[model samples]
Structures are given as structure tokens and as C-alpha cells.
Target: MMKVFDEYRALSDDTLKPDQPKAKRFIEAMRKFLDKKENWTFWLPYILTLELCVKCGTCGEACPVYTASGRKEIYHPVYRSEMLRRIWKRYFTLSGKIFRGLAGAKDVTEDDINALAEAVWRCTVCRRCAMVCPLAIDNGLITREIRKIFDAIGIAPDELKENGTRAQIQYGNATKTPTEAFKDTLEFIKEDIEDMKGVSVEIPVDKKGVDYLVINNAGDYIAFMETVMGIVEIMNYVNADWTLNTPDTGVNDVVNYGLFYSDAELVAVAKAQLETIRKLKPKVVVIGECGHAYDSFILYKKLYKEMYGEEMPFKLTHIVALIDRWIREGKLKVDKNKNPEPVTFHDSCKWGRCAGVYEEPRRVLKAVCKDFREMYPNREMNYCCGGGSGFAIMFKDEFLKFRMETYGRIKAEQIKATGASVVATMCANCKGQFREIIKYFNLPVRYAGVSELVANALVYK
Candidate 1:
């Protein structure tokens, strides 16, 4: 049950020797990052995460990665975090310098860095581990910081970098959808929504001074057009003053894969998105169907307030929370019988754990799902979809196999146990993860978005 990542296996025999230029560069970057006090602000959570760990294995029991690995020692939540602690102590702490070997501080090396780098990317940053820890130590946050260090040395998962981070910085969206194509996609979605739902709705684009600038995961428009339609249908039904900004992450696609790779990248992508909102001067920014993007916005909004001396001119809210509000307000009459199948909700780590959005999606689900069954350990304590970070998109042979058989297996079993034919998820990644697991495990389950369920349950007057 050991989950072996071939990429890590390939990286283990590292060529970045102590005397090599690459090693020197990597070490320099590591030292600069470790030595800086300003970065302490960025890494305070990681510092708290590393310092607070008591080597208690309680979190390991809760970690899907650790559990799926047959409780492999390397995959334990403590493994990489403890490694970071030792490295930090060795390089940065006085006790480490005075006591050295007695303090368990060892000299940092290329091999040590390589090992930690390899191990960190294997995690999903689901933060479920943190919930179970007595000290509330977050191994997921530690892993993400380690990935940023690895990324500083130009070591990172390519799927997230070339396709995700780089694309977001360059095009304002990770999918690399051109500005014109984005506009066209919106127009197409409006038409498609009208045709499919018999709801002729105007999809606003770049219209300034709206109360809300609603943005969704651009991936939905590209891969799941119906999700876009569902979101628009809800907006039109509510007669909300909203506009879809399709041009960039600044105004449009509200996803930031940089959260998985680098803090700098996360900030850059957020600034672009924030600048777009500022230009539009919307009252509230509603993130649609993408949990992590909302997570990024929540984190970055605070950071922006710190850096810019004032919060942006907009309030931030997730569509799920907004939908729940609408349901409670009787703004949309829902017919739960429209979804006749037994359904269960899967909590996106970002929405439920990271963002504390526990009840909104379920409340929305309950509004539309007749036979909604609760998955064991649902909400804040829920298991990851095995693709929380970005694994669902890594389709390479060995990585894909590890993803499905190792990370995704437990989730697939969880759904199978639910006896629910439809599994509802808010995050696009969660949906993709479940879809993959259903295929791999041959389970009788299909994925549905909360918006999709809402759209289905809409009482068409």
C-alpha cells in the first residue's frame, strides 16, 4: 500500500550536487527565504504548523494520503513537516547552532532538500490533518510552503506551472483562453443556456458599476458548459446586478493554482484579479463553483489590505453561500423531486475546511436533493477527493495510476459506501477527482455541481 510517485523516484537521484551551479542557486534561494524576517510574515502559519506538531499521529489517521498509503511512514503527515522543522532549526535557530547534533539539527543538503521537495508535492494540502491534531498543526500548509521553496529553485509540478501558474500570470486565466474567445465563450454560454433551459438571459460582460462582478472557474465554461449556464440561470432568476468578466483572472476566471506552487505566484494572480475588480468597482465579488479560488481570494484579500493600507472596494462571497441565502429568502422556488436519485455531498477542502464554508453547500443541497444522504465524516472532517491540489489533471501514466489507485481509492470507496448514485461537489477539481475514481473503481456514481442541482430544481414558471 505504499504510494510511490515516479516523479519523486526520478528526482531522488538528484544531479544538483553541492558544488554544482544549480545546487548553489538552490541553496542561495533557500537561505534567502529562510533568513528573511519579512517572509516570516508569509510563513508564520508554517512556522506555527511546524513548531506546534507534537509527533502525535492523530492527524495521520485523518490524512487521506497517509491512510491511502497503508500508513506509510514517509506519507505520514509529520514526515515532511518534521523534516522542515529540523532544517529550519539547523539553519535559523540558536538552540540548533549551540546544541547542533544534540538538538537534532542536521546540516541542510541537496539530498535533504530533494527528499522534502519530492514528498511535499505528493500532498493535496487538504488541511484535514490539521483538524485532528491536538495542537491543530497543519501539515497541509507546511507542505504548500515547502512546494514554494521547491518552486523557488525552479522545482515544481509542470502541470501547475506551465499550464496553471504561468498561464494565469500571462493570460489572466490558467486555461489560456484568449480574451476574445473568453467573450465568445460567454456569448455561447448565454445562447446555450437559453436553448437548453428555455431561460433567455442576458450574460453581462465588462459592464461597470454593477453591485456584483460574478466570476466562476473558467474551466467550467470550457469543460462543463452547463455549470456556466446554471450559474447564469440563477443570477438571472434572482435579477441580480452581475456581470461576467471573461477577459482575465483579474476580471474573470477566479482560480489561482499558484496557491499550490508559490506564494509569489498566488499574489501576482490575485493582484491581477483584484485590479480587475477595482476597475469594475463592483460592490461584492462572488466566486462561482471553485472553492480553492475562493480560498485564495480570502487569504489574499487580507494580504491586500495589509499591503495596500485598505481593503479593496468590494465584498467577497462564494456562490454556494449566496445560493443558500437565496434559498432561505424564498427568492427561488426549488423542487427537490427534480433530483430523484439518492445524492451525497463531498466537501471541497477549500470551501469546508479552509474557508469554513461548511453548511452553505449542504443547505443548498438539501434545498434541491430529495434523498440526500450524508457521507460519513462529512463537512470539516471530510476526506479529500484525492485531487485537492491538482492531481486530477495529471494524466501521465505513473502519476495517473498513483492518483487513481493510491490517492483516489479511499474517496471512491467512501462514495460507494454512501449508496448514492450522484455525488455533489462544489469544486471543479473535486468533481474531476470523483469522476476519475468512479471510472477507476467502477462505482455507480456520477458527479454534480450544487449549481447544476439548483438549476435542475428551479421551478420553471
Candidate 2:
């Protein structure tokens, strides 16, 4: 048996830790995982990446964590992937069988499992390394594979599993918002929007045959009410038909934390969300202000076809893209004077790079802000807010420290260089991370969602 490093084991609330897997269990899990032919198509590139890496060190330079941590060897982009490669060589490769420990092949041990488990979480899995890779290898995909193994063996982060996806599955949201509470939250938001923005917007719930089925991260209702308000205001302004799934409908959040580690969890959550979507019967589904939610649905489309032998019924679109089109088509008039301050955007990895949603948010920002500054490397090549892959919510004390000081340091520097008073991001995770890092580093910047900025600038006549 192997105990995880102290930092990796601590829960976000500091109250409890889940059981760690033993060495024998880890070996069995890996053996079963590698042998499964169903997973080969998914994992083949990871195996190829292992064989293809040439130690060119270009990926290391592109890694924010490695560069921010002063190039720590352990935090290298390929550091953990290299460990998996060695393990594969020792246990499954012919060369390793013939020349064990002779050419960088090390036998798998409890320490390796322990060390590898610890190393995997340090990454945001932003795939910036893959973008810069000469051979198109993705260290991020390899990292997720390693994480999937530990997650299957019951050794994954508690925030991502028990308290996250499980809670979402049970209560219709990751925050454990019950049926009554979700209804009450909608009521409160509707009233708050009327009071604050003077807009009497009806938040439609479980309304059948709507043109759009709008979904958001459940956390937004609690922590980012403005984002939800913005969506409501915009939807109402355009007089578009949309409905939110009530808790009784068995869908509350768009978050699929399963995308971080486990495919089974991904499919399970998607299945649950899809159950609600099918009930509501909308023409299209809109994802609101969440990056992983947007990316996971794209993953789910493929999985849905494979599992059910048909295409996902509804067309998918992002809120930013919708807002941009609304502005271009003059459906919503906006006055930039309402937001007369310097602003910059922090692109969420999954939304911007993975989903190719770069230009829409920028167009919305330019439409709503007086002074919009560009972070040096904007769009697809942008750096992560360092909170990708669910690390923003993993609030363990040591992990928190590493996130603020190391992982998020480069982002803070970028924000500072932009000299923007507010950094507007579309994704909830990026907003949360920027909020923390701004406070942690004491930077003179406020975090705002693109929707919030748009709401502020909406020309109400």
C-alpha cells in the first residue's frame, strides 16, 4: 500500500481524506485499464506520445507551472508522463523485459504510484504543451490518463468526485442545491434582477418546447449571480424563448467534472443532463459562462453516439457566441460608456483553445467596454488562468498555496502587464481563479465575467 503525499490527500475543507489505493490495487487497475480494447482508441495517442517524445525541452518552456516554479524538475510538462512511460516499459514492453533498469526503465513501486499520483494534480491539463509540441504530442491527455487510473482505483481528489459529480448527480447540482432551494434561488435571482437592474425578467423553468435550453454551472447561482442575471436580461431583451431545467427535471448544472479524470463519470453526468434536456424539448441548448461545461458537451456528443447509436438531438451553442451574434445583428443595443474603464480578457483553456471560442468573447468585450486591452498572447495561444481541470475548487491548504504562488503566478503577471483595471473572463473557473490570484497577489484588478460587462453596458430604453 502507498500513502499519497500529504498535500494531495487533504480535503478542501480540511476535515477528511478518502482511502488511498494499495500498490496491488494500483497494478491491477493499470493492467485492466491497458488491456481494455474499448479504451485503446482513446489512449493510443498517449502511448504514441510516450514513444514520440525526444526530450527537446520545448514543452517545458511552454508550461506555466514549470516556468512559474522556477523550472522545478518535478513540475516539468512531461515529468509525470515520463514516469508513466517508464512504468509501461518495465511492465509491458519487450525492451524493458530484456534490459530492466538498464536504459531508464524503473520497476513500478508504491513510491512511483505515490509520486505519480501527486505529480498529476499539479497540472491544469491546459494542453499548451501540445500546441507547442513539434510532434503534436499532448502531455495534457497523458496526464488525464494517469489521473483516470487513480480515480478508478478510488484515489482521486474528493472535490472532483464525492463532493462534486456525485453531489451534482444526487441533488441536481455540484453544490447540493435541493429542489426547493433551486426554485427559491431562481425566485431570488428574478427579484434581484428586477430590483438591481430594474428588469422584470421571468426566469422560465421546465417550460416545454422552448427555442433554447439554457444551462450554467450551479455555482453561478450562489457565487456569480450577475452572470445568471446577465443571461436572463439578455434572453428577455431579445424576447427569445428559453427555459432552465427545474430541480424536479433532474438537471441543475452543466458542470461535468468527469472530464477531468473519469470517462464513466463523464458519461453518467451527461446522461443525467441529457435526461432533462430530452424532457424539456428545446430547439437548441446554450451553455452559459462555463468552460468545462462547453468542452464536456462536445466530448459527450461523441460518447452519446457511441453509447446510444444516435446523434444528440439538440444543436449546441455557447452564450458568448450568442451574445456576439445578438450584438452584430443589433438585437441588443449597447453603450460602451457604461463601462468606461480599462479591461482585458483571460481566456479559459477549454472554451478558447479546445472549443475554438476565441473571437466571440473578444467581440462582446469590444462591444461593451471603452478600453479593451489585449493580454499579449490572446486567443488560442493564451495561457491558462491556472485553474483548469477543477483545481480552482480544490482548496486544500497546501494545494491552495501552490495554486496561488506557482500555477497562477504567470497569469497574475499577464494581468499586471495589461494594466487593466478589470479582467473579464467568460468561464466561471477562470473568474474564480482570477479572483483568488488577484487577492492572493494583491493585484489592482477586479474580475468580471464577459456577460456581467455586457449587462452593465446594455442600452435599456
Please report, in order, the local distance difference test score of every candidate based on alpha carbons: 0.78, 0.84
Name the candidate that leads on lDDT.
Answer: 2
Error of 1 at 126 (Å): 1.0
TM-score, cand. 1 vs. native: 0.92
Stretches of candidate 2 exceeding 4 Å from the true structure: 1-21
- Candidate 2 achieves a global lDDT of 0.84
Which ranges in model 1 have alpha carbons more than 4 Å from their true place? Answer: 1-24, 94-100, 248-251
For residues 215-303, what per-residue lDDT tens digits would candidate 1 score against the true structure? 88878887766677788899999999998886643546788888877877788777878788878888888888988898898887687
Colliding pairs, model 2? 168-173
| Clashing pairs in model 1, backbone N/Cα/C closer than 3 A | 172-249, 250-273
Number of clashes recorded per candidate: 2, 1
lDDT of 2 by residue, 287-308 (tens): 9999999999988788778767
